[model samples]
Target: MTEDGGRRGRHETEEERADRMWGELIQEVRVAQTGVQILFGFLLTVVFQPKYDRLSHSDQVIYIVTVVLGACATGALVGPVSLHRLVSGFRVKPRAVRLASRMTFVGLLLLLATMTSALLLILRVATHAGFVPYLVAAVVAWYLLCWYALPLWARRRHPVRPGDRAPDLPPGGPGPGRRQGRT
Candidate 1:
């Protein structure tokens, strides 16, 4: 507890915090990895489709770019697992976790670009309408709002103060009305 009798931050050592964070990061990565891998696999088969040969040269270029971006996203999202395997038992969990988090963020950005380009190519081929660009832009804006804006807003609004307990945890102790039993 602090001098004012409020609960302190999570009672975890740096290593313990790193372990917890690594677990959480891996779970998040798993979700992204599945998505990117599926998208990448689909992109690979597109080139063999009968309709693919009929597409204009510019559309074909867009498809190629989208496929490349999807492959890059897949690599970045899966990099953390390989990193952990290579660094296991080296006593660098904290650093590994930070690097993994950065890779995941980059993966998300690549995934966004991949999806945006894929949508643009599909809409252009389907309708050949002048409004296709506007439609794609609207969808990208929605993705930004859902994936980035809301999270940043919440982080700024609920900045964690030093010595404050984790929000999900109870205020007093291990159990209701009981102080921590530590000596």
Candidate 2:
């Protein structure tokens, strides 16, 4: 604990870091879970609408697929909480965190697919023009850019070596201390 206080940059132990990460992950899940749940609920109601009966067979199929995707997205987004609950007190928090993170990523991907499908269905129903596919494709591209491409690009642009200290840490925050010359 050379002047900076403790081991890690934020002077946190392993458990402390895991705790912080879990908190952040939970907050993120809350936002995504709310969205997916709402979308799924709405999707569930669409079949009961009077207009649903007027849709062509192909459109009905698309609606069915979209609703299924929404349900899957909802499950994936809610998975992390279930994982945490089942694995609590198991003494494998780091591993649990990793698994939860993976679940969250999968959940986000599913959510993207659900959203794209829903948008495609909506656009098709709203307009029978030839531009619907192009429009949906453009929107999908935008979602990919926002969701994956930018984050990957930034990560590649600023690579961190294995032993490198965290950026958010201040100078002399936490690392091996320098040794003095022998007398």
Candidate 3:
């Protein structure tokens, strides 16, 4: 909430702000958690597949690294839930939120690594052509652009100033034709 009735418009105390931030953070975590969990699940099954025995030594190592990254990502993404549960009644939600945010960031990075490793292994198995490495590099560049570059550019270019109020949306939704009442 901000001073001007915009986006998350409303005046809120420090505690209220923390609460709202926590809710938003949790929503974001839920999305990342689902993705990492599913990826980790698939990685786990790979080791038991008959095709696992046929991978080259290098490919096998890549698979192992990917599995480890997936595990780390899963742990980090789920860490915030454990952290919140442990700290719930301590009157330190603001601090907890900060720590959880770090954990989420680490989780996202690990997910990126896991994805890159998985892609490398898949491409290696799918083709032995000389262009495979170049292809993987291109895809990694795209991931970097999409996952890290754009958000950072926006953050740097359009930062919220200390006293500036963000534009607010209507209560029902951001625009007209949104459901105005209970449906």
- Pick the TM-score winner: 1
What is the RMSD, in Å, between candidate 3 and the native fold over all Cα? 8.7
Q: Which lDDT value does model 1 have at 142?
A: 98
What's model 2's overall lDDT?
0.76
* Residue 126 in candidate 3, Cα distance off native in Å: 1.3
Highest lDDT: give the candidate number. Answer: 1
TM per model? 0.84, 0.82, 0.81
lDDT of 2 by residue, 1-183 (tens): 223445634566556666777788889899999999998899999999999999999889989999988888888889989989998998777667667777888888889999988988899999987899899999999999988778666555664443345433345432222111110
lDDT of each: 0.81, 0.76, 0.78
Cα misplacement distance, residue 96 of candidate 1 (Å) = 0.2
- The per-prediction CA RMSD against the true structure, in angstroms, equals 8.6, 8.8, 8.7
lDDT score for candidate 3 against the true structure: 0.78
Error of 3 at 67 (Å): 0.5
